[model samples]
Target: MKRLRSKYTKGEEVKFISHLDLLRVIQRALRRADIKVAFSQGFNPHPRISFGPALMVGATTEGDYMDVDVEEDISPHEFKERMNEVLPSGIKIVEVFEVDVRDSLSSRIKGADYLVEVFLKKEVEGLEEAVKRFMAKDTIEIEKETKKGKKLVDLKSYLEEFYLIDMNGERAKFYVKMKLGEGSPNPFHLLKAFNEYIGDAFDLEYYKIHRKNMFLE
Candidate 1:
């Protein structure tokens, strides 16, 4: 048996589906496609299936991925066509690649790239200044609370790369590459950091954030 990594897109409405539900749907489709999966020896005996990092609800994605094991070698083309035919609408098989059995999809992820579109509430306040300032900070610290408790970390340090492009008028789209921040920071958290740095004039609700790319380090 070999492991296969598949990338998929959660189009429009399907973005509302949670990760667990998506797994159920994929498992059902795998059964319909007659693919063999390794199973656990435990009482539950679930198939050996692993997924990449979860995509948040309400966010459309083109880079969400999962890893599954098969009892026999299957070409990426055949597997992709078969699975795509059976997968529900809004969920699709984009690419299927053979991966080392020992490698983990989760651990391979080093960072994710995002394209955030921010629309000004009014005729623009100081967004350009805010973005420039936020992007230029030597260190931008924010409070992040986890089960281990809250800790302050530098936002700039976690940021690997970023770019700001003004769309039209007061609208701007930011292509930001963060080091996965390691501690599970979200787009809202990032916006919060910018607001904190530039002083509370930034409004998150006025903007729409899209995750353009996800990467493995």
Candidate 2:
């Protein structure tokens, strides 16, 4: 058996699709491509496939990854080409490589990078100062809902990096690295803190967010 790793992209056109639907789409595409994918041995056998971190719905991503155990070895180039031919327009295979099954992408992922563009309802000033104030605090606590209940967390702890990339009169661009794994903070939580800090004027739903990179460590 050969373990293959493939990088795929989710464009804005399909950002609204839930993560489960995206997985289903790829599984169907794999079947249509006629690849000899391996399956688990059980009564209700499923594809021997694994995925990296799940991207939030309504957020586009370019660095998504998947691992599949296939029955036969296929060249990386041909594997990518075959999958792309079957995948939907918004999802495309970017690259494929042979991988050691032991070093799984999901297991190794440490964090992810995001670029968020907030289009202000109107030209708002002092956005840069707000970011600076957020960064300057000793402890930035924000409320987050967990499986048990809602809890307050220190936002500064889970943030690996933050930068104000650009700010035009009408839009503000922020690049942030959010931690993953157990006890890691969700980017959405940080955004909530930002919205609260900026007051109710800037709604986060109007933001254009994209996952630009994934960090494996």
lDDT of 1 by residue, 1-217 (tens): 7888898888876877898999999999999998887776877888888876676676677786788888877888888988999998998989999988898888887777777776654455666666776688788778888789998877777787666676566666777777663476666678777756555545666666666667875
Model 1 error, position 79 (Å) = 1.3
Model 2 root-mean-square deviation: 1.9
TM-scores for the candidates = 0.85, 0.91
User: What is candidate 2's lDDT per residue for 131-153, written digit by digit as tens?
Assistant: 88888888889877779898888
Point out where model 1 deviates above 4 Å.
145-151, 167-170
Q: Could you tell me which residue pairs clash in candidate 2?
A: none
After superposing all C-alphas onto the true structure, candidate 1 shows an RMSD in angstroms of 2.4
Show where candidate 2 strays beyond 4 Å.
Answer: 121-124
